[model samples]
Target: MSLSTTSLRSPRVVVIGAGVGGLAAAALLARQGLDVRVIERGQQPGGKLSQLAVGPSLLDAGPTVLTMRWVFDALFERLGQSLDEQLSLRPCAVLARHAWGPEERLDLLADLEASVTAMADFAGPAQGQRYLAFCERAKEIYDTLEQPFLRSQRPTPWSLAWRVGMSRLPQLARISPFRTLWQELGRYFPDPRLRQLFGRYATYCGSSPFDAPATLMLVAHVEREAVWQIEGGMHRLAQSLAALCQRQGVQISYGREAREILLRQGRVCGVALDQDAPLQADAVLFNGDVDALRQGLLGQPLRQAMGGRPLTSARRSLSAVTWHLQAEVGGFPLSHHNVFFSDPADEGYRREFADIAAGRLPAAPSVYVCAQDRTGDPMPRHSGQAERLMCLVNAPATADARPLTEEELLLCQAQMFARLTQAGLKISPSVHPLQRTSPQDFARRFPATGGALYGQASRGWRASFQRPASTTRVPGLYLAGGSVHPGPGLPMAALSGQLAAEQICAALRSTRRWQPVAMPGGMSMR
Candidate 1:
């Protein structure tokens, strides 16, 4: 359900970060006539929606694929702008191209029938029918929770069961919360290869299929519903939203960090920024990881906002080692998205998870390559003489440790490229526009939290509610980002910001008239 927000009279809201959650909240609240100011420590608006440089070629460093387009469409629609009009997007015909080796390749296409045919050709008719059934169950999980859990402020299994009614409680069981995704996939896919392909969805949130909740299979249905490629790059999607925020009268300040969250009484008032005077406001929305709040990075007094539940390093999710490459390649027929699985004997998924559990990099990592320059056409595509590509190899959540040593980095890089070459994507080391990002690098990029990309992993059915809600123990404070409720992914983070804006609007509506809101200078958390 959408909030009926009326225009307000200059109530100030200071968003501490300019990431997707920050940008979305600011844009929507600005539309509600709130005086929104977005401050970022970086030069660009996007936090995780970052880009890498290879000579003149730039590749998207994070989130190469875009799915759940409706989330974005709704956000833009509320601002009186069409998402399609603001930016060009092409629907991907081939959702993903998967390969085990040179002779073993499968293309999951946009069309379900096409995919069924392809799967049948790859496996057999029985397997193809089972694939369709898998899609059905995946869709059921998404449809069951999309309303009560996904769109709500915060939800629990009890709340979800109540929403679904006692009669539909069996659907909850059907979601298989008790089983790991690997076990659940076995019921539908007897072939280990197919299981591996579908189970890879667990890593979408940086979790292992062997242990992640079976509910995560909903990801397959989510992506299969629709996928699009924004023009220019995924980073451009962030730029477009930032532009919309500016156009809607949001006061955006970059290169500024929030020194601390200001408080008046037990409630939030605004933020104190570095190198400038502290700006006061009615409330503050923290759009970074909740772990930052628990660590008292914002301020010790602000820890009260956490409502006593603190985040620990033990529950943090997975991290990665990514290579952004700009090069001219031959041989391998690259697609917009591709994956090269490691040896089957190693139980690639199990072995990799074990290595991460031990804080050691995987011996034979499953590599994901995104040829950013490649389009959906049958023939390969690129803008210039060379192409931009990126390969991501999963690694342990090691953002808190010392950056990998030279020897370790070399070994990881060697292991990654060797598998890539063996899987038919042969590229010379001389490839221009090459850069590598380690887990420690990610930690530095997004402070406090180790390089856990998806915040906390969705370990079980109960894991979803472990994240804090939009409204915290502190009356006027709010949480919005991947680290909070609704789980991780680009769309979920954007939705989180939207939910935060709605909550703030509701609270303000109860406290005052449409006149205005302000703060005092003498405010202190202590």
Candidate 2:
């Protein structure tokens, strides 16, 4: 049963969860000529990036905004291909429009000078100039940290300290790793409104502006560098990735739930399906939430390695409540992206996290709407015809705290409609519940997620390194996902997959001989 004694050669990798991370790993490994199989519990692949049908229109269930295009480009380049051939991406002229109050509105243009000009018009020229200064500082931080930190899988504290120490100590102060994102903004802009506008970037990863570190200002650099839209929808990117994986010879199994991780003599051997049939593999790469793997999905042996800590047992990132509307209104003078801020942004955030902890709903919540499709334009139809609208509000992930009561659903729907009306989108449309992925639902669908979209809450000082590493205590096993290193969002998830694949490749290159151990009675070692 020992992996070292096994006579097998050539590692066969079985990846559980065919989401972005899993697919990315599978594609990379398969390209490396390893036998790779991807199993997904959902009816289709793509995990959170999957598409849903809303009447005649299609909606992307996750990540409407596409940032950090280089991450995806590099992935394709690694396979000796071009992303432009696989999928067409349109550069967005207007990143997003933000509304602090009904009277106060600002548009973040893709053109830096145009954005500064717009800010000058809205706030003042001084504020506009300050914004330029702020962006310069953000760029400095991004340039100094992106390669050594974000693009790699080195998460050990000592590794971080060494890297920071090597890069002149004064540069660390310039990055503002100690101050809150809001506090940093305060130092740059004296206007409260201007601070609030830039502060919205914190929510990109579902953290509060008041709490997230100033280092998050790099998010602005990422968006301003290149904001893109897929030609059809964000889901098209997922579809393209899936197509690429298929072309690379990856075996994808949909609706096949993995019941356990089968181990032999303390090393990863294979996986057991829900039907009790065991599929043997030389190594296992988990693309799903690692916390779930450590809990019990892979059975007792994996759980024991985690010291009985439930992955969902920890505090999670913010959850969202989204509504997909198919309405009859055309030529709507709305941008591709929009954020309608509720009064007192901090209060709304406080309510969301508090409700998640206590199991309740926030009274007033900040809402975001995405009307743009793959073309960075609205859906084309007859003039005055209704268009599709995707509305989302930050909410607690725990269903027990934010139950889906009939009255509560009606209230939320009504509130959303009223807010939309106030924002100037006049439309009475048929609403279809394409999908309602709450924090509790996230835990159910992504067991290791603990209802957290980004795996762990990025609140503390060590939060950056708090992201799990690819290598685990169990030999021949690795992890890749938003919950792991590099953190969440589409770009980070893709990076995690690449890092995991690199680790696997490195392990194989050093070991040379691949070993597959036998399972006794076809049961998990748990």
Best by TM-score: 1
Name the 10 consecutive residues with the lowest summed lDDT in model 1: 517-526
Q: For model 1, how big is the CA root-mean-square deviation? A: 5.2
Instruction: Please provide TM-scores, in order, for all candidate models, with all chains considered together.
Output: 0.94, 0.90
Q: Model 2, 436-474: lDDT tens per residue? A: 445566667776554656666666557787778887888
Give the alpha-carbon lDDT of every model: 0.82, 0.72
Which candidate leads in lDDT? 1
Model 2 reaches what TM-score against the true structure?
A: 0.90
User: What lDDT score goes with residue 206 in model 2?
Assistant: 68
Compose the digit string of candidate 1's lDDT tens values, residues 187-238: 9988788888998999998788887889998999998987888889999988
